[model samples]
Target: MANHAKAAEYNNTSISSLKGADRVRKRPAVIFGSDGLEGCEHSVFEILSNSIDEAREGYGDRIAVTRHRDGSITVADRGRGIPLDFNPNEKRYNWELVFCELYAGGKYRNNSGENYEFSLGLNGLGSCATQYSSEYMDVTVYRDDYRFDLHFEKGENSGGLKKEKCHYPHTGSIIKWRPDLEVFTDIDIPLEYYQTTLRKQAVVNAGLTFELHDEYSGETFEYCYQNGIVDYIKEIGGEKSFTEVQFYATQTKGRDREDKPEYKVKLEIAFCFNNEINLLEYYHNSSFLEYGGAPDKAVKAALVYEIDKCLRNRGKYTKDEAKVTFADVQDSLILVTNSFSTETSYENQTKKSITNKFIQEAMTEFLKEQLEIYFIENKAESEKILEQVLVNKRSRETAEKTRINIKKKLAGNVDITSRVKKFVDCRTKDLNRRELYIVEGDSALGACKLGRDAEFQAIIPVRGKILNCLKADYDSIFKNDIIVDLLKVLGCGVEIKSKHNKDLNTFDLANLRWNKIIICTDADVDGFQIRTLILTMLYTLVPTLIQEGKVYIAESPLYEIAVKDKSYFAYSDKEKVDILAKLRGKYTIQRSKGLGENEPEMMWQTTMNPETRRLIKVMPADIEETQAVFELLLGENLSGRKSFIEENGYRYLDMVDVS
Candidate 1:
């Protein structure tokens, strides 16, 4: 009985309706898509869209926008001002219908070509909804040789329309408003948003100018494109494009379905292929379609079909080569599609995408025909496009294969300490305290293992000299057991910079197993050569370790001096001379032996002890200079390497091993 009573309490009285302003104010996301910064930005765009529509309709050629420091925005245009006079048809003032009502606008009669043949403000929600969501709005209109002013506060009319006789150069509308903080969680729209939106609008609406004044930054910007997307594409592709820019345009009539009304569509496309740059943008009715619902599908289908057909006809494919995909074409394609229609079916009020079926079909057919004609007319350009697209396809296929092989090789659940042969791990699993010593040869490894603090120090031996990673390809480097085992012990993957091998890169600095990677070797030529090889491998495969200050070199003494009961170590010739000068009584000095010949205590005191050992942190301040040196020494710049050796070889002659 109690449950039945509770359910019956939900009656008609409990389901009250939201009133005029409350409909949008209370439930903003339902109309604006978000009650956050995105909603605020959309509200601004809504006001801007009206100005853009007027400009595109030949009413105005310029629009001015100002972002105030107090979080208010002003959009002024030279279009025939919005009519706010009485309307007998609706039996109400035009201001009431436009500022207070929903689903009422001049664009509804677009099919008759009476007003806004191709309009961006299609939903009629832009103006009223934006007005409803603002803290305060002031509208000024100059039309009919008179000036009209209206003000609203908190979605309610504050003052009746104020009309006055005035003389003005051009008829226009100006609106200034600040988004309500109560309705939106955030309203601090960024300046970049204005710049990007205005730039895109200018690109689509050719010959139209947009001026932006940012009071916060005290900066003003202007955007205009005389040739629209063609000019924009050239700006992006630059002079290095392999093919010239191609433009195509057509106008047609279509309907989404038999039940839907027919409408006119104007399509324009501009494209070029560049090896160094690639971009794709879509716009409809001067509105940037970020998601690109219909045009995106149409472009991908047409380009892939046409390119694949050409490759087959030209005998560019192997016996069983798969057809090219949209990604392969997109890898090098720089394209822009600007289209407008009398009627549009936007996915939502925000208008990020359009889902009209007829638009897709029309575009696909038009693009296919144009591409066929272009290929037949320009053989050289078509051949170049085909070759580059084939190269992209082959490179994608190779990257996939390499990615799979690398994943398999690097995958396992087995304990790394047990799987990696001859690799000794420390007892501590704490990453911040753990250290790794990469010693040269088995003899040095044995000594280091005996001398290191087993609680936090691990050791790995590099037998002989490993492959020079800077000169060797990835496949050869990975095939070597020494490098592979070392990498496995380190527990971080490689960083691949090649365009074709991007998929093979799986590096994560957080997964590195050690806090410090110390290279422990003798102070002789062979030991130095082995150390350089190890460093080259690290610089090639995992430069992030060195960049993050985790790599170090354990400095060994060059001379050992014994006086009475104390032993002193000298790391350089100057240091040796200084130590001999400081000694008072009889002293014996001798050259330090290799790492393998040092006793466990001597190794600990000189190479492994945290308090007494000397360690040089390896960090590159200028990566470009470091790269140049590495390339001259180990890369395939043979002539450069020869010149460098001729100039600097004498300095290293004493360290060189002729035996």
Candidate 2:
């Protein structure tokens, strides 16, 4: 077996062009950033988003989604039906043109005819993209007393638009389509996902009722939040607020610049210092942002500044006292921020983050003013809040010192890698070729050190399981010696390591010490638990490493079968059986209890040799699913974990060991 790089430069590459729907199918990841289950989910959201945008633009308020049993989805909204009148510009019905054209929609401009003050779809690739990837799409629109129907097969018009009388007597839009199996990996719309998304939309867009009927599951769910973000905060963060500091604020500022289009910005924020962490979700035009942008940063800054200012005014601390940090502010802050921008700039094609520069200044001013008013009106509660802030400030100060000390102690230096007793590092300074193997115990580390290509591979040993980061905070990660050592060795410092003293989310990935991070633990039960801990830590703490395909697990052999003079490694019991049957000879089988039990040469042959070794790549196909599993198993709750073990523990009875 030979190992090669997929990213190597190939000379004389031919330039090509992919146009129309064929272009979308050729490079799906260019539009969706993925072709996995997440892409399928996004397809559903892209269609639903158009309907949601119509409601946002002062249309009908009801939006419904149905998950059919035959791998089909139907999204219906009682919103203003898509423009059905003939378009003189395109020389076709507006409805047909909108569905067929790639970059055709009402979201681009703000004119009186088809003005969209707030919109989720700006690329004009929402329903059209869905239609392009679907086997067939059927669209029905009703406006006044007329009903218009249009159909498409893989984004092309099946025939032409048909007009008829409206018997339903309602003005709305219905889009029904089944994903083309040839184009997608899977088309099944997950029920739990739809339920959560619909509920979240209802929370963001108040007065809008969202419903989901999963025919496959034979269940119906609906969401209607009249109080909107404020109510959503209380529901998730609980009614009991820290010092009873619970309130909502609206930041509405109109822009009337002649150069720019007249824009109405709606910034709705609900805040509660409940001393509990919940779904502190951020949104812009109802699109959920996993890594929040300017608005989220602004809100956090405002809370820290305003609270610190209020405390200083009361003469609670000396001028020399340390200012509060984001960790201090966010520790107890349960918030829901919904920013509606008439025109928005995003960092990527997925629209995961807003890059608007005005959001930071606009939001910070609004929040600061609101907090100042809250403190002045409720002086007693303000004192209680100040007390908690003092406690947090003390903890943060102590943790900061400890974090710096640990960074120096583990790495023997702060920025550059220095020789450490525990880590047997490689010689090469090239980051790309460098590999870091985190082994379970000293024995496995010794084995790795002996067998490894010393020019590239480095080994660090852990005594036992490191903290499961799913349940650990920055303080826990900073204070623990083992966790600190691991972070220092990796050089991708956990949350507490920031040059600018920013929050965990701002931890820079460019500082990563190694190009490849491989878990080389023992082949046993305890080793599996250790690997799980390391995986959870990396997945939650430094997700960029996993997303960039730097994380892997070395698969050590489970059994060594000696037949005659040669030995063959078997990864599973099935493989062992096959090897024995094919050899047709009496062989002695030794079950590998641990990597430590194997010889250095044996370890190299079975696991370390890159050419033939089986390295299982840990790619997080769906991060949301991965997070849910980790939380359920590694969270503070014992009941859910216990129930899971009791019901599914048998699956692990015949499991293979890991390296």
Candidate with the greatest TM-score versus the true structure: 1
For residues 1-659, write the lDDT of model 2, one tens digit per residue. Answer: 89976876666775568777886666666777666667777888888999999898888888989999998889999887888778787687676557766778877763455467778987887777778778888988888678888888876777688888777756899989988777777766578889888998998998899988899878889899898887787777665676542555564654434465545577878777765453477899898877788877888888889888987888888669877777676666678888887778778767788877666677888888888998899898788778777877776676666556555555445433344447788899999899888888888878878988899988888888788777765666656667666777777655433322353443568888898899987666777788999888887667778888989999878899998899999988889889888886688999885887678888888788888788988888998898888888888878999999999988987664444
**Cα TM-score of candidate 1:** 0.93
Q: What digit string (tens of lDDT, one per residue) describes model 1 on residues 432-454? A: 99999999888888888889899
TM-score for all models, in order of appearance? 0.93, 0.60
Local distance difference test, candidate 2: 0.78
Give me the candidate number with maximum lDDT: 1
